[model samples]
Target: MTLFVALAVLAAVVSFVCSIVVWKLGLRFKLYPQIRERDVHTRPTPRLGGIAIFIGILAAFGAAWLVSSLGPDRFSLLTIVFENPAQVLSILGAALMIVLLGVADDLWDLDWMTKLAGQFIAAGLVAWQGVSIVSLPIGGISVGSSWMSAVVTVFAIVLVMNAVNFIDGLDGLVAGVTLIANGVFFIYTYLLVQQTSPFNYFNLASLIAVVLVGALAGFLPINWHPAKMFMGDAGALLVGLLMATSAIAVTGQINPAAAGIEDLFAAFIPIILPFAVLVIPLLDFGLAVLRRLRAGKSPFSADRKHLHHRLLDMGHSHLHAVLIFYAWTAVVAVGCLLTYVLPVYLGTSARWALLFIGVGFVVCAVITLAPLGRRKRLTVAAEEAPAAELPGVDELAGVPETHGPVTAEAAPVESPEPPNGAR
Candidate 1:
């Protein structure tokens, strides 16, 4: 646990520092595209944030390799940096491949089909590296053939990969959601790794989770509302692949049968945990497809009707909408986490705790959904408002300036005229 903490911190600091460098370099290189009507940002901003995150993850992995190889053997059972070097490299290599795919999409704005081809190819690489989902529990028994497992593995990876990509509608939404999900998975995996019967200290999945949390945490400040740069498809794909890999490692490598988890869902928890953690993203993706289908539009087409966009339409502030999403994600993911954890740690009392938490989540969500008249007025004003001329430097500095004419194309789209952030 101590060693894992150090590695996580290392990744966070490295990601933070590297992101700063990437931010500046992206601006200098002018690697951003012009603003689009369907897009969020009002002004041009860099989309190379993923490159920095990937580099940070790379550095952290390197650090882990060095520490485990040189450190005393006592801690050897706690880390696989020295013991499973191939696994580490394979994970990193898979992530790197996705990053490359994301980078291409971010820069070229590739069509959906081309991007998907890259995603499947990257997912295949992951499965080939020993992180395939080898089984699925249907009844009380495991069910899968070798060929079936390969197909299921690729499909699962692609599902998560695009779920993250499709949900990248608001600033920090994907990163923040994944960060929370990663924390839950880390705790669950760490606890699993603590068992002494079959595996006293096999924490590869835990390591991946914490490292991911760190990387996302380090990037969050820059990605918060009023973002300076976007993670683009590169960061989204890379992060999603990392998350999927962690789940695959546990499900494919570790046996829940050996875990002896005392729950109705114990047999399937390994397979179920990933979906539980990613419940929100998966729901969003599913709803999006249904929505587009009902409208007779291609499922891959982009739109402004995502959940976050709906919140915005309902007159919620950007920050408020994001927080609401975060709250819902926590309630769902954490509730799912407790399903396995509280049972083990809290025993019978876990049932009452789960019930109370569930109630609290519903109440909070209900209150958040309640609308106010002020917001409706604000929305109306924003829609009806005419564009105004850009304020001069003196006006910006709070010094009075003469009125100027607003350009047709440069006019404001909203009443308050704030920067447009993409969904």
Candidate 2:
């Protein structure tokens, strides 16, 4: 346990250093993006943040490999029956491949279909590794089926990839949120591993999550508000894929019932944890698709209609909007933790916690909707205003009467009657 934790910490440090190097490289290579209409930032920012994160993940893996090779008794236990470490390598490899795909898209503005194809292929590779959902459990009840697991896993991977991608709107938004999500996963999986028997490979999953969190933390300094660099599609997609893979690996390997909770729906619980952590993005994805379809537009078309965009429109600044999302993600993530820790008999606590979550959601909703509500009221008031009392363009124009000639203050107001005459 100590060795694993140390490796994770080392990986984070390496990842941070890698981020700094990458930032320098970006500046020297001139790999910067221009300000676009949809962009939230005002200045040109360098990219290639993905390189740093990738290096960090690789550095962590190298340590893991070295440990396995040196201490055959300790690390070799990892290889004895589960083949978990190798599976982690495969998953990481898929993430790296997707990162490359993202980099290509970032640099070249790759076509939407092309990007989608790349994402699907990346997901396929991970799915191919046989780290798929294999059953459905309702609370503590198991409805085991291999085919259902496969479908669910594929769907989850694809959803998570897009979810993280969709929410990568502001500087440090995706990176920060991802780090938090992964951190939660790491803690949960670690605890699970500690409580379970030796055969449990939960530790490896947590290790991956920890390494990812470290990499993102390292990159955050460069990617925060008034960012000097952006992670581009490469970083966003890579983060998403790793998160998705980690969730599956952790949940698939553990039985929730082992925690002494009698899950009436055991299979559903594993799936729910990841979903809760990612609720904001996944919900936003559904909204995006529905909105695009309603507008008679391509579902894949990019636009400023995301949840963050709506928040910005409602008067939150970029950082505020990002933080708003961070708060919500934290809330949901903590809720997940509590659900896991507290047994079913303490159902009342979970219910009250959920009620609080609902209130939080309502506050966000009101903030989002209140401005439009005010606008509507203002419009209605304007229509009902007495025209005689309301100042008109002619009345406010400050033009002197022609018969009286120009007053010293007005000088006949020669500026085309101020067009429409309303002030």
In TM-score terms, which candidate is top?
1
TM-scores vs. true structure, each candidate: 0.84, 0.79
Question: Per-residue lDDT tens digits of candidate 1, residues 212-242?
Answer: 8888889888888788888888998888888
| Tens digit per residue, CA lDDT, model 2, 227-248 | 7677778887888888888777
Q: Lowest-scoring 10 consecutive residues by lDDT in candidate 2? A: 414-423
**lDDT of every predicted structure (CA atoms):** 0.74, 0.70
Error of 2 at 169 (Å): 0.7
Best by lDDT: 1
Regions more than 4 Å wrong, model 1: 71-74, 78-84, 137-142, 196-199, 252-262, 372-414
